[model samples]
Each structure stands twice: as structure tokens, then as C-alpha cells.
Target: MANVQVGNGVHRKHAKNQRSPEESVTEHESTSMGSDYELNGSTNTEVQTDKYGFIGGAQQTPGEIDDVPPDVLRQREVKWLEMLNSWDKWMAKKHKKVKLRCQKGIPPSLRGRAWLYLSGGKVKKEQNQGKFQELDNQPGDPKWLEVIEKDLHRQFPFHEMFVARGGHGQQDLFRVLKAYTLHRPEEGYCQAQAPIAAVLLMHMPAEDAFWGLVQICEKYLPGYYSAGLEAIQLDGEILFALLKRVSPMAHRHLKKYKIDPILYMTEWFMCAFSRTLPWASVLRVWDMFFCEGVKIIFRVGLVLLKCMLGSPEKLKACQGLYETMEHLRSVEPRYMQEAFLVQEVIDLPLSERDIEKEHLSQLRRWKEARGELHCKSPPRMHGAKAIMAAEPPSRQDLQQNPTIIVEASQGHDSNIENGKRAKKSKTEKNKDPNSSGLLNPYPLATDQSQGLLKEGTLQGSNQSLSSAEHDTYL
Candidate 1:
């Protein structure tokens, strides 16, 4: 059984014997806990044997099993429950306090709900009820199905949630991935998305998990999991640039070895440290990431680099990318603890502004180097649904939809060929703005169109058409 040691902490098996770095690397390599750690341990009765004859579980309550002390766990539960109740007030008025609380750590008991709120999963889940089931009922793309199935057992195989081939955990994981395939057909399924969605499932229901996966893909880390993973490649350059400023010697040493940031940071950033950090650290990092955005990830990466290979001697000791990667993968449990790592990440001077500045600069450099077009940044996903609902559609979109703006165009005497004027009745004039065709130009209005979006039924519809053409757009 492989065990992790950190900061002179006791060596303990990770639920089941955790796989070593070598095993993970050789195995096509992949990749939690109860409420405390969002772990899903099985009772002894349910433990199943894999082909290798590895068994998982203990006699105690499966969800209650955790490494955190009982008092600490209780305290966190109480604190988080209070915050969860006043979530809206705190988020809107006491945001700094919220960030502080998140930096401390979200209580495991409330982590699922907290994450749902932080990632705006509730709105999305509500907007897409039954969609996951619809997608699941259909046979998925065979290529993605094969890849997802192969990676299922590879991720958190020791945990009860995903230990068996067809357990609820694995089943939920499948539904979430399938829903994402349905959600963003352009990107389809990426190997990296599985670990992320699996972690979300450990805390929330499958429906919530699906939305959280959507939030992560579209909001938190856009382009990171896309077809070419272009954002990830760009961030690799960004990470190296940041590394040079924070730890020049280590940066130079890695450069000397021709060890690219992709060799290490791909799994680190794409998996959001799920594959690199201990389970506890992964949870803590996620708590901050959900609250603080992607900057937390960069800060955590910097801190890990500084801790493991900050010293010239240590950097010199690593002969190649494999050694550097093994060193990172084998982080000591002591330093990897939530209390320790979270504080270090917080103390680091890395800021959102810094990350944004660096990202723009790096993106420009990348575009110039590759002669690629500079596409507009992805739409801001922070409270996106609510924001879209509150705001009116752009004039351009209103013009595009001839049905909604027919009278407006006539009043303006605009040269819109094939457009006809339609008069509104008193009842139409008194109708709500959303129902008066004003909001229909953009499909974000609350209506059946969002449901069509949820089920991916409108995949073939022309986006330029008016809201009347579809029930709504998301």
C-alpha cells in the first residue's frame, strides 16, 4: 500500500492504498472523502473486488470517515451552515468576509451547496432540470463513451463512490460527462473534465454536478478543456512567465532541462490540482477557487513550485521532467494540509489583477507568435444568467430579430429588406417587457427555450433568428 508523508505527519493509506507517482504515470494515469472531505466510502458489505483483487472500505459509517479532528469538523459544519443560510446577503454585501471564510475552508458538510452557490450551479441546475436525464437516455457518442468508461475506474478507484463499475457514483459521473457533451458539443468530452466532474459529484447530486461541470467549463476555466486546450497551452506560457518572476532559479533550471510547464502544469491546472494535491489539499484549493476564481489556482501552483523546488540545490537535483513531476506528485502530507497550504496560497502576492494582466500580455504574445486572430474574451459567467435576465438585449440583436423589432424599424424608417411593420394592441403595449418581444431578441428570457437548450433540442436552430423561432436562448 502506498502512503503519503508530509511535514513529518503520520503515514496513512489514502482510504485504500493510494497509488504512487510511478504507478499513476505508467497506468494511463489518473487521477475524495465524505462531507468532511467529500469522500464516498462504501460500507464493508458493498466493497467490490477489482480484477487486481483490491478491496475498499471500513466497518464505520462510510460518509463519516475522515482524517480531520471531530471538533474541527463540527466547528466548520456550524460556521458553514450559518453562512449558507445568509448566502445572498453575505455574497452581495459582505464579499470580502466571504473570501476570508473561503480562504479558511468551506465546511465539508456544506461544501456541495456552497460550491453550487459559488459556481452559480443552482441557477443553471434549475434552468436545466431533467436535461441530464434526457441526455443520459440517449446513447452517447461511442468514442467519448469508450474514453469516459476507461477513465472512470482510473479516477478515485479507491473511493466507494467510484469503486465499482456501475455504482451510483460512476453512474452520476457518466451522466454529468454526457450532459457536458450535450452542453458544449464543440469541445465534446475531454479526459481532464472527468476528474473535475467526479469531484463535484462527491459533494452534490448528479443534476447539480452537471451544472457545476458546465460552470467550470464555461465560467471558471474557459478554453482550458476545449478541443485543442488552447487556453491551457497559453497558460503554460503564462505559468512559466510567472515562475521566472517568483522563482527565477527554478525557472532557469527547468528551462535548462527543456522541461516545459505542460509537462507538470497540465494535470495541475486542468484537473485543478485534483491529480496533484492530496485529497484534503484538493478540497481546500477548490474552496478558494470557487470563491476567488482561477487566480487561486495560479497562486497554489506558485506556492507548490516554491515549496518543492525553490532551492537551487533541489532544482539541481531534478535531472529531467520526470523527476520534477514525481517530486510534485509526491507532495508531503504535512505541507499539503488545508491549514498549511491555504495559508501559504493566501499569503502569496499573486492577485486577480496580476493574473489578468499577465494573461492578456501572454495571449497577445501567443497570437503574434502563431499569427492567430484575437477573438473576444468569453462572456463573463459570474452571475451570468441573472445578469442576462435583468439587462435588455443589445440593439444589434434586436435589429437582427425582425419579428420583435418590426415596428421599431418602421418607426425609424430603417432600410431592412423583407421586413414588415406590425402594430401592437393595447394589451400588447401593457405586456411585460420580456413578453412584449423586447427580451425575445436574445434567448435569455425565462421561457421554454431554455428547456430546449437544456435538452440540446435546438442544436440545429439558427441562432440569429428571433426568440419566437425558439422559446428562449441561453
Candidate 2:
């Protein structure tokens, strides 16, 4: 047997004290847990492994097994495979069904592929074919690379993949984070991203993981991993405000103790609960998070507070800030079980509309208290489905439509054909007062043009504004 250090600093001996001849020859084969364990000589010790490959006593923690019936899992896998094959149609016509399925759970076998599809990582990879390779080929900035190297061992260290120092798991994690720094030098790297990227690597390959991290940092949660983390701070305020309605008792307790939401929630929200929730619940929450967006995160937080501190009896142990923080950090296992947490998140009344309304209110309050925000990038489209919905018409679709207007942003002269100005005939120009030598047959009335522009209908052919932008067009 060989001693192996698993995640969280626990050490376990190999399963068998002596390897058979066949076992020795096939030792390098990948396991169902998605990692290859290397043997280091032999000893007489033995230990058991969990379904997820956590060894020894670490298996006592929750989420160690697949609780779903084999038949149910098979059926869900079939449905998910069908949805993935006709993803565009499902997203366009049967989104509710997709949401319902994601809420129930994504099959373990299909989770990696599903996450790539749901995060629009697949689409992003398609758009920028060789971008990750380009970034990977270059040596990353020393500032970020140095910090990233230090944090690599700390991410899921007990997991089989990352257990060995400089192992493939840590190596892939390094590539993803280092590539990100080169991709967006200004933002650099955030320590919080390491664990998030580690979770992605567990499911997908390194290239897919890089794009998934890109979608997460840039699209799913804009401005979140920035230098000051101003966006997450703003979201903390929004979460607290929403807590008042979800659990007034919990709100009162925090307010009475003067406990800032950021103190407890920074890790939870920043890592999307990867460090806080059990392994199974984290996957379930992430399935919904990548499908629906950050609202799922908010709901999970609100549910935790409501379950842990919503009542006077529950709050008895949480008499002060220290106790409250301690309780939050070491949450009782019962409160974090996948079935319970998923149902609570699903039943919660929180919606994206509610989050946005509170976001605006918080923004106004922040400006009043501390002037303008540093990061003004507009909010991103929520979820993988929203990203897919906002995708511009495909090149083939554009090529088929000859009369479509050329967007000015694409370095095209909107009014020119070939190398010359496309002038309208004098008779036609005089017949339609609103005509501007474009393809629009139903030209807007003089008074309607400004309103139409304000409404965003006049932006451009290729522009794909988010639903929020459409709702708040000005």
C-alpha cells in the first residue's frame, strides 16, 4: 500500500496491500472518478474509496454517493442527451422543459458536456477557435503566474486529480488561470477563481475549462473578479436587502448585531458556494447557476440564512457576530443536503427581476454614499441560455439575406456599395420623406424615429442587446 494525501489534508493508504500482476499492468488507466492514481511502492495498510474518490474518513462527509435510482438516472441521461443534440430547438421552443430538467438535476455522466453547452463555453470555443492555445503558448505575466502557482495546491487538494503536487489537475488549473491573465491582463487573477476553475476542470478538459472560466468571469458575473471586487460588494448589499423579505427574523438578527453581509458572504458568493456547500449540492447549484444565472446563487444564500437563523430558536446560538460567523462557516450538514437545498432554492420566490430592481436601488445608494462606481460595464446576459438567445444570426443566415443592413461598428460603410455611395433615384427620394437610401420599406415617421432609436430597434442589424437593455432602453 502507498500513502496518498487527499483533499483537506487527510491521508489514506491504497485499497490493496499487494497489487496483482494484472493490476500492476493497468495501473495507469483512468478511474470512474476521472483521475489516475499513481502507486508509490507498497506497504501493508489499506483504506476504502468513495464514489467521488475521496479516501479514508473523508468519505463520512455528505455527497459521497449517487442517491438517484439507476433507472431515473438513465432516463434523465436520455432526455439530456436528446436536449443536447437539439439544443438550439430546445432553447428556443422548450426552455421551460430544459429549466425543469436542470432543476431536477443534470446526470453525472453528462454534466461536463452539459456545463460546456449551458455556459456557452461551446459557443465561445467555436467563435475563438485557437484563442486559448494562443494564450497558453505565451508565458503569462510573472505577477499572476507566481500567485497562481502558489494557490494551485490549495484547490481541491484532497481530490485524486489534484492530490499529487504538480499533477495534471493542478497543471490544467494553472494553464486555465494563467491563460486568463494573458487574456484579460487588466483584471489579472483572483484567488477565488482558482477553486471555481478547479471545479470546471473536474468535469471538462483544459481547453473547455478555460472557456468555461471565461464565460463565468466575463459573462455570468461581470466585474465580480475585478481588483476591488466592487460588483460582489454591490451584490452583498442586494442579498441583505432581499433577506429582509425572505426572513425578517434573520434580517433583524444581523442588523441588531451590526453584521455586514460581506463578512460571511464574500467567500460564499465569490466562489459561488463551492467552498461552502457539500460536493453534491455544489454540483446541483452549479447546474442551475450555469443554466439560470446568479439568481440561483442568491436563492441558495437566502435559503441558508432562513434555515440557519430565521427563527428565534435557531438564533439562540448565534448571539453575536463571532458566533453567527462561526455557525455560518461550519454549517450543519443537514442544512446543506442536496435534495433539501435544491428544493428550497427552487421554491424561493426570488427572481432576476427582483435582483435587478434591488441592484439599481443599491447602485443609487452606493453613488450617494461614495460617488460613481469604478466599473461601469453593463450587466451581462444571465445564464448560458440567455447567452445562446443573444447570439447574433449565424454567418450562413447573414449570407442568405442580401438586403440586411451593414452595421457601422463592423468597419462597413452603411450607405456604400462596393467602393461607391449607393444613391437613391431622385423620384424615389422625393416620394418618401423618411427614406434615407436604406433597405427599409416601412420607414419610420419623423416623430417615431427618435423613439425607435431610444427603444433600441434602430441600433443595428448585428447588435444583440440583453433583455435588461431592452427593458431599460433610454
Candidate 3:
């Protein structure tokens, strides 16, 4: 019942494509078809809920019945679907001529329709291979060819690189991506396209890769590549916060050691963890991402942190920054894949509810921490800031603060007789000073004065007190 979210739904696109933002948010509601109550006073078996409205079918996961009548909701939903279908046709026809960028990793099957739906291509041809291919083959439009040729090898040149390098999977990747760049000039070449392009080469045909790539760029990547960076940074921050929350001890140790998890995870986000996570697991994360939008990313980040926290010895072995990154990256994409699935994972003694409890535990500790920040520092001790702000004489403290002071030795036969005289004179002066404190001539303790009448001599060893007491003066 409490529906709330912070990040905006609308994703911005490259300027040449759709001139506005595409909605990124998706709301989960009950299904819609119709109600059990019969409209004509007959026994109606239909059951509809608002959440299942999108599928235009009943909820796959049924729940306790609500108070609303299903038949009425179903009737309204039917009308709504018809209205949207008509609107989609109008919009598709309107933007049919507009060019855009290709997406990554042959867009998910569910995603093709979503992209076409969002682009208004649902009705006509936001994703028409036959027509677009004709447009490409037939050399009437000088502009389209000119743009495609210009970017033939500009951005994700997987195929071009293959033609140049002749290695593993480059040829197929290059072909599909280049084909897409040609078709969609507005979204011609973004940086993140490569990994996505690479992934697309796996499942979809080259042309499907091209169209799926289009959907991904338009709906998923969020704006241009630069805009993609912002999304990456935002996700990185959220992940860092989650890490600190889920593994406070590890986070504190990292901080104490001047280690930053973001340096490791930021690359994960910027690259879609393509290089880090196994080939399959990355797809799973993407599956959740496209379906649930960015919230799933936050959830995925928490899961990753939880994964790392599962073993400290394994984590500790990762010494350097890159070492830590490499280890996590090596989480055997298969094992990680297994980590999230299965009844054990669900019953793994943890859930989102447990995560919330962990988060609250952190919050409670944070509130109860040393929140009291007093300006008062070590009393009577010199601080750098104070030394800088004080008079010129105190400036010496700045340089002296970092210097090591050697303890001077004391006690000797010759100095002992002089010390007695000096003590007697000081005691007499102290009594008189009590009567006239202002006139007390406090002798300046000159550091350069070697009381033994020489510097660095064994003669002063007798004056040296026990080693235990020697450190007291310092």
C-alpha cells in the first residue's frame, strides 16, 4: 500500500532520436480481466486484479481476494487496452521516419515489444527489418547511407575489428552492431554498446541483435553514453552505501586501510559487470534490471555485498585494489548464478525483510555513534590549525610537531654540586616570588645549553636518570 520511489522513471535519449524522456518506472498492480460477479445476473467465474493488468491476464501468482469487483475492472481494462493500442498506432506512424541508436545484447524477448511499445513502433515499424533493410540496400536516401558509412567503424566496431583482427567473436558482433548503427543514426554509437553488442551476438541473429540493440539503447541504457555514466555513478553510490550497511566491519577495515570499494564496483556498473561477473550471471542481473528497472540494481548490489561478506578469509586474501576486484570478478559466474536461485537461496536464512533489519541495525548504530563532534581538541597540546592561526612564535610548533625530540641525560659529579646551588637559589627565589610573583625572573630554558659544558659526551651519563624516567620528559 505504501508506494514510493526516488529515482525518476523517464530515461533521456540521444538528441536525434525521441526528443523527450522515456518513462523508466514500472508499477506493479493486480491483474485485470473481469470480476466473478456476472453483469447480466449470470454466474461469472472471471477474476481480475489491477496488478495483472499489463499481461491482460490473471495474476500468475494469486493472492488473497480483494474487495473490488473483477468483472468491472476487466471491462475497463479491455477498453483501456483498446485505447492504448490505437494510441500506439498513432504514435508509431508519427515517429516511423525518425532514426535512433541500436541497443545491446539482442534485447530480451519481452523487451522487444516493450521497446516497440514505448517507441510507438508497436503499431508500425520502430523495429522493421524488412523495410529498414530495403532503405539500407536501396540507395535513394543519401543521408542514411552517408551517416551509416561514416559510423561504419566509428563506435562499436566489433565486426570491423574482426575484419581487421580476425579473432573469436568479433565478426558477428561487428556485423550486427554496425548494421544497427546504420539503421539508427540518432543513437549510432555509445560507448557501453560494445559489451552489450558482444552479448547480443550470443542468442539473437545479427538482425535481431540490431533491433534488440535498438531497444536497449532507447529504453535501457538511459540517454546517451555520457548520460549512462551518470546512471553508473548513481548505482555505484547506492552500492557503496549498501556495502557499508551490509558489512560494516569489512567497510570499516577497508576505510581504515584506505581502500575504496567504489573503485572496484564502479567499473562493475560502467561495464555492466560484463568483465567481472560470469557471462550468464550478468544476463540474469540484466533480466532483473530491465524487468524491475533500477531498483533491482540496488537489490543486486546488496546481494553482491552479501556474497563478499559470506567469506572474510577469501576477501582478506585479496590484498590490492585490483586484486580485490579480480577476486570478486572471479566468483565463477555459475556459482554466483546458483547463489541467487534455488529454495535454499530463498530460505537461506535471509530475505529482503532481513536486509531491512540489517539496514535498520546500521541506522541505529550510526545514530548512537560518536555523533557528538566537539570543537575542543587535546587540551594544552598544540594542533596544526592553532599553530597556523597563532602568533609567529607559535609557528615553530608547526615544524616541531613532526620532529622527534631526543631525551637529554642528567646527573653527574660536577653538575651535582652545581645542581645543589641552583636548587637552593631556586627555592629561595620561589619563596620571594610568592610575595612578588610579577618580579619572579623565570630563567629561559635554552635548549642549546649543554649543562655538562659539552655536547654528546659520556660525562653527562651520571646525570642520566633510569631509562624508564628518561621517556617521561619527552
Candidate 4:
């Protein structure tokens, strides 16, 4: 049975009996055994044992983790030390190798720091040292407080840290989320932000977690958690396009029932697969996701679709969207293993170039359809349900109503925006700003130019993806 650690107390139910005192957890390793890190504010190191003498808690027992041969452990330790000692060099010049290293997995002891580096959180934390506290000290928007409060315990209820109603985990979750609301009032607080914050808190301290969340929301997945969720909708369409090519049988079967990707994929994309994949797999996905870009997500999604309903027989069984969702969510744990699923993701033929090309193609269609936004009932694509509840405007809307797009694009702070665009040449200023790579299609609700708003938006297409069998030519 799983052992439940309730703060300072260890509650053992169905697990094995306690170990011999000689074999009891050591003072140094007890707290850090599970999750590769101690839960914030947890001080008790005594691990309770079940009837079978097995240790239990939110994580695997020490013996289970120690099952790895000492030689392998030592080798990993050496690699971890090498990574820590030469972090800057790895990040700057040898990032491709760093990606390969991450694919193997980051040492639990070093995962926090590695994630910080991967997400650029270390620099972000330094730049915004007191910002979180400043935001915390101020009163939060009344509108979002209740939502945050309601969603606190929902984050990681089974985990010891967040199990209690007013525990440190939930408190930190609130502070991090609330600070984000204060930091970016326009986006306010979205329910999806809670899980991401909760996952960050699980691995790092509150302040560090806060900055990581900031990097994720503002930098990693721009426009993702905003009120409209335009990015999710756009990506849903992109996924549909990819599905048609990757798994035509599954794609067509779903379309036969008019089952849309949005119905099942919204939460998957919104939470970065945090809620969809198991904890172990989720961490592995994060390891790669931070190293690469959102391409990891698309690839993972493809693998999931292929696994869930790639065959005609399986797809035929799903009578409707609801059934399709159930089948998708019910994928076996064995197949979703971190190593196996990640290897499949790596082997996937999909590429960022594919997603970028699809995104541009879809954006052009959306741009053509902007005049229909006021129709109050946006036309569904091929009779599929709308992924974005708030329909995005067409490109014509940007040309005709430039001010709306300009104002909507201003939600982010100027410094944050500068970080996104970097430097421009004097000669570049003479050219049309709209024609610049800076403008891209965002969603209609954002009323902002979304086509090329960020540096990462179009750059993914240029990167080379190595296929499992061969290098892809894009």
C-alpha cells in the first residue's frame, strides 16, 4: 500500500512493516528520498513502515530507488557533478549534447537546478528577486482570490505537502499564483496555472517556483494561460492537421463522429501534460520540454493519439467525442512509462517545422474569417467543435482595427516585451512593423497580432530534428 506522509507524521496503512532500526532511514536521506527532493517545510525524517516491513510515503521506498546497482548510481553521480561544474558552458555552446543528456534523465538531486537552467529560471529569479514578495504584500484582485482559493487543494491532494487545507504547499501555491495575477493582471488567474504552479512547488522553493512559473507562463508558453486560450485552440487545429497525416485512420474515424481534437486536447496542452500523464512520465516530459520548446508537446500528443486510436478497429469503437476522450484518458500506465513514451516521442516523425507550417496555414484561414467574429457564432471547421470559445479575428481585423491589436498586445510589461523581441536594426525600422517578423497571429480575443510576436514563434521551424532512423530534411 502507498504510505501517506502527513507532514511531521507518517501514516502507514497497507504498506509493509517497519524496517530494522539498523536499516531505518538515515537523517540526511530520509526527507529527500521520495520525489528526489523534500516537500517544502517538511521536517520529519522518520518514515513509517507497513505490516510487510516496507517503508511508505508519497514516493517509492529507499530500497526501491537503491535497486539501481551502485556502479550505475556512481556513474550518474559523476555526470551530475560534471553538469553542475560546467553548467554555463553546457547551456551556451553544448546545448544539443545537453538535450541528449536530459533525454537520459536529470539526477533527482540536481533536477531543481537543471530545471531552473532549462527554463531560464535562474536568471529570471535573480532579475525578479523581490518582485514576488512585493506582489504578495499587496492585496490581490478580489475577482481571482476565490478561484485561487478553490483550486489550491485540487493541485496535489494526495501528496503530503498539499493534503492539508492550509498546508505550506497550498499556501505557496496561492502566493505564487496570486503573485502572477498581480504581476500580470490582464491574464489574471487561470485554473490551468494552478497545476503548473503546484508541480513547480513540488520540486523547488516558493520563490524559485514563482519565477519558474513566470518563465513558463510569460516565456515558455506565451498566450497559453491567458483568458482566451487562443494558443490551445490554434494548436488543436495544428494537431488535427498533423493527425490527418500521422494517423489518417484515427483522424478520419474521429471526424466521422464529428469528434474534435479540442474536446480532449485542451487540458492536455493547457497544463503541459501535467494532468494528463502520470507523475513520472510528466517529469520526464518536463525535462525535455524545458530543453526543447513546445514541439515536445506536439510530438507527445501525436504519440498519445497513435497509441490510443491509431488503428481502424480501435477508432471504430469510439462512437462519439465523449467516448473518444474516455479512451484517450484511459491509456495504460505501462505504455506511458517515461522511458518508453519519451523514446516514442523522440522517434516520432513530427517536427516543429510541421507545426509551424500548419500554424501559419491555419492563421491565414483564421485571418480570412475575422469578419465573421461579430457573427457571435463562428463557423466550426469541418463541423468540428470550436477549440477556442472566444473566436480569433482574421488578419483583416488587424489591418482594419490596428489599435485594438496594438492595445491587446500590451498586456505584457515593456521589459518582458523587449526580452521577447530583442534588438532591431535602425534600417529595419524603415520597414513596415507589421511586415517585420515581430507580428504573428494571436487569438481574436487577445485582439493582438499573433503571427510573429515572439522570437521562438517562428524559430522552431528552422531547427533540425534528428529522427530515430535518420535525420529529417526540413
Model 2 lDDT tens row, 309-366: 9998999998889999898888888889888999999999988899989999999999
Error of 3 at 324 (Å): 2.9
Per-residue lDDT over 207-317 for candidate 3, one digit per residue giving the tens place of the 0 to 100 score: 445555554554444442443343344335445555666667556545655655556566555445544553334555554343323334455555565566446675677
**Best prediction by lDDT:** 2
The predicted structure with the larger TM-score, 2 or 3, is: 2
Question: TM-score, each model?
Answer: 0.66, 0.74, 0.38, 0.66
**Tens digits of per-residue lDDT for model 1, 55-146:** 34321122322456756754565555455545565565777877787877776556777777777766565555577667756666767766
Count of clashes, each model: 11, 3, 26, 22
lDDT of 4 by residue, 1-474 (tens): 444343333222211211211122343333223421243334554445422122433322233322336456435644654554445555556667777877776655456656765676665655555776677677678788778888876775655456545444555677788888888887889999998988777667667788788777765576777655666777788898888898888788778778777888888887989877756677778888877767788888888888788886776668787788778878766567677899998888875567678977887776687522221222222100111112222222211111112232444335455553533532454554434333322222221123222322223221111111110000
C-alpha positional error of residue 82 in candidate 3 after TM-score superposition, expressed in Å: 20
Cα deviation in Å at residue 141, candidate 3? Answer: 16
Model 4 worst lDDT window (10 residues): 465-474
Give the root-mean-square deviation of each candidate in angstroms.
17.9, 17.8, 35.3, 19.1
Off by over 4 Å in 2: 1-47, 56-66, 392-474
Residue 191 lDDT, candidate 4, scale 0-100: 96
